[model samples]
Target: MRKTLCDTLGIEHPIVGFTPSEHVAAAISRAGGLGVLGCVRFNDPDELDGVLDWMDANTDGKPYGVDVVMPAKVPTEGAAVDLEQLIPPEHREFVRRTLDELGVPELPEGEQKQDGVLGWLHSVARSHVDVALRHPVRLIANALGSPPVDVIERAHGHGLLVAALAGKAEHAVRHVDKGVDIVVAQGHEAGGHTGEIATMVLVPEIVDAVGDRVPVLAAGGIGSGRQVAAALALGASGAWMGSYWLTTTEYQQIPGNAATQQALLAAGSSDTVRTRIYTGKPARLLKTRWTDAWSAPGAPEPLPMPLQNVLVSEAHQRITRSADPTVVSMPVGQVVGRMNKVRPVADVMADLLAELDETIVKLSDLR
Candidate 1:
């Protein structure tokens, strides 16, 4: 696991754990992998700045990174109020009807609904970049695609490596061309927003296209040490894992997450479905009644990038508040099948390395 990426990022293993939990991210770094915090959950730059401060104190001086949601092509940008106007009434009604059908309860009286994630907007994402640059972050990753050229340049100026998620070889090439320091070749089986290529094929294709120019990190459906070995065999410098971390004990510490964790523990590899109902982009999510309802007859087509998320943001809150595991909305990969137990992040990291070593010895004996 001691690849160039490890040396570049100053970590023991080449694994990069992406998580929204600051605790999980810090734990991964302390355990020797670079933990990249997902910044999209923070709608306010000050909130992100405070979290980074906590990360700085908790990571034990280990290098960690931040992942932002800056799309290659900017989406409609505006204040939350202005963006709310763009959502069609039909979509709002659909969300309301679905929540009613699912028996999801609303917030208590006088408890206002939390605003939609403004981080999906370009302005908010850029603010994330600005806040991240001020921290001691070693890497900055864009979740959607290649970030704007100026953003890439700014990260470089701060002496930070820039990485972008690519679902295609062409997208990988484009990232390298735009001066991206790393490319995360995330496959169709990945959580959150993703494309149609599977990891087994996408990794090598991306490596062949840009491996010589920049290190490619293989993502999607990677959860164990054996899978990490496979990623290395496919020429990836490291493995970028997201979904597997969701069941970590540290992640379970997040308030109101028990139901979502329970759902992940109960899932199998075949229990996932790729749908555009999440973030208005094709994202792999746990198969739940909510996702199924979006596919039913008379369900309107999902709107594009930010709008769909805004329209359904309140509905997601209601679902989470409802505490129904069968109806919770979560972006997770097929790896959820293997995420049966809630263990410490350190324990999971140890198992991954142990499995990788065992796999290496088995393969060497065959020679």
Candidate 2:
């Protein structure tokens, strides 16, 4: 699977693994793939600094990246207090009621819940960029859109690549125009925030549109080596996989949320739904009671990004702490059907390469 992307990123495989866990990221890079660490969950710059420090020490001098959510626009303005006030009481009450109905219990008196929507702000995202650049990060990716031009230029100044995720071909062009080094064409089948397009159609469209300008990485519903091969066949230089890494042992080691992993293992492709109930964007999430509640009649409309995210942050923390399977909201792709068991990151990477080689041989034999 060695391609131009591999050369560009100085990796052996054209696979780019996206995960929130630093262990998983380092493992992917050590296994000859580029690991992109998700930074949206880090509310404190020091927290991110610690993770990057661990990654830098553990990646065996391999290339890895950082992913941040830098939306082109936001609803709240001025200060953090202003942003919290943007969330209406009704929305907050709805979230609380949904959790109550799902039997998700509140956290213990001494323990505190994590801040969910803090990192989505521009200031926090900028702090992430600042922290990542201080380290030897090879790439910095923005999940929402093309990061500010200043971010792009700053990354370039440090000899780092800037990547952006686009759901449409035009979005890819815009990213390229903004000096993005890589464009990840994530389909509607992807986890977290996504747009309405399938990978098969979106990949080639993005490839044809920006094939000559920049490298394209295909995402969404891609969990296996066959899917990676298909992405390369469609002219993508690599496969940017997120859902596939969720079940890795390295990921499980972080926080060790076995309930979430168990839910993913028990899921089929159809067990997911695209709804804005989670992050106020059209994101694919596990069809649990929380997601189903939002679709019920008389359910209030979800507020826009940041507002809706803030509305449900505490509820999510409660559900997570409770470890309730029915109420857990894990962002996953349609490819969850294949994630049936937990495995080590090294073993998963080796199996993927082996499968790719076998698939290639079979194809060559057919001719």
Candidate 3:
């Protein structure tokens, strides 16, 4: 797995783990793979700055990256109050009715409801970039698609490599054309916002389209060393894995996520469903009663991007607080099936490398 990506990113392996947990990200970097922290979860730049400060102190000086959500076409941007006002009454009623039907409880008396992710807005995402640039980040990845030209240029000016997630061959080409240094061909099986292309088909098509121009990382349904080897065989410089890290012990340490972890541990490969109910885009999420309710008759069409998220944000909180594993809303790939047991990030990374080596030897023997 010692591809040019390893040398470029200054890691021992070509595996790049995408995680939202700072501890998980640091652990991955310390274990020799580049860990890219998801930045959209941080609505406050100062908070993100403090977290990055912690990351800098930790990770043993190993390289790490940051992923930001910058939609190509900007969405409705405003204050939380203004955005709340934009949500239709019908949508609000739907959320309320659904929560009631699910028996989700209200927050504790003093607990204030958390707002939806503001990072979906371009302005907020740009602030993320501004904060990230001030850190020692080696790479900046856009979760939605190619970032703005000036943003890409600014990252380049800071001597950071820019990567964009692409779900199609054309999208990959466009990323390269827009001066993106890396293209992550994330398939439909991927979590969060995704397109209809499967990894097995999308990886090779993207590699053929832009592998010669820039390194392509294969994402979606990749959790083990065998999948990493397959990604390399398909011309990817590395495997970009997100879902596989969710069950790591580091992530398990996060507060109020035990129910979510239990749901992931109980899932199988066939248990996932791709639905627009998550983020108002086709995203693979764990099949649960929450997702099921969205498909029932008379379920209104999900609002686009930020608005839909805003509408359902508190509902998600209520469900999580309800501590019902069967009703928790989480964006996870089909790989969640394999995420059965919790292990240290170091152990997982070791297993991945060991499995990759064993797989490589087996493939070599076929000759």
Which residue ranges in model 2 land beyond 4 Å of their true spot? 78-80
Candidate 1 lDDT tens digits, 78-120: 8889989999899899889898898898877987887788787
What TM-score number comes out for model 1? 0.98
lDDT of each: 0.92, 0.88, 0.91
**Candidate 1 deviant stretches above 4 angstroms:** none
What is the TM-score ranking, best to worst?
A: 1, 3, 2
Model 3 gets an lDDT of: 0.91
TM-score of each: 0.98, 0.97, 0.98
Clashing pairs in 1: none
Candidate 3 lDDT, 307-332, residue by residue in tens: 88888889988898899999989999
Clashes per model (N, Cα, C within 3 A): 0, 0, 0
Candidate 1 steric clashes: 0
- In model 3, the worst 10-residue window by lDDT is 1-10
User: Comparing candidate 2 with candidate 3, which one achieves the higher lDDT?
Assistant: 3
Candidate No. with top lDDT: 1
In model 2, the worst 10-residue window by lDDT is 74-83
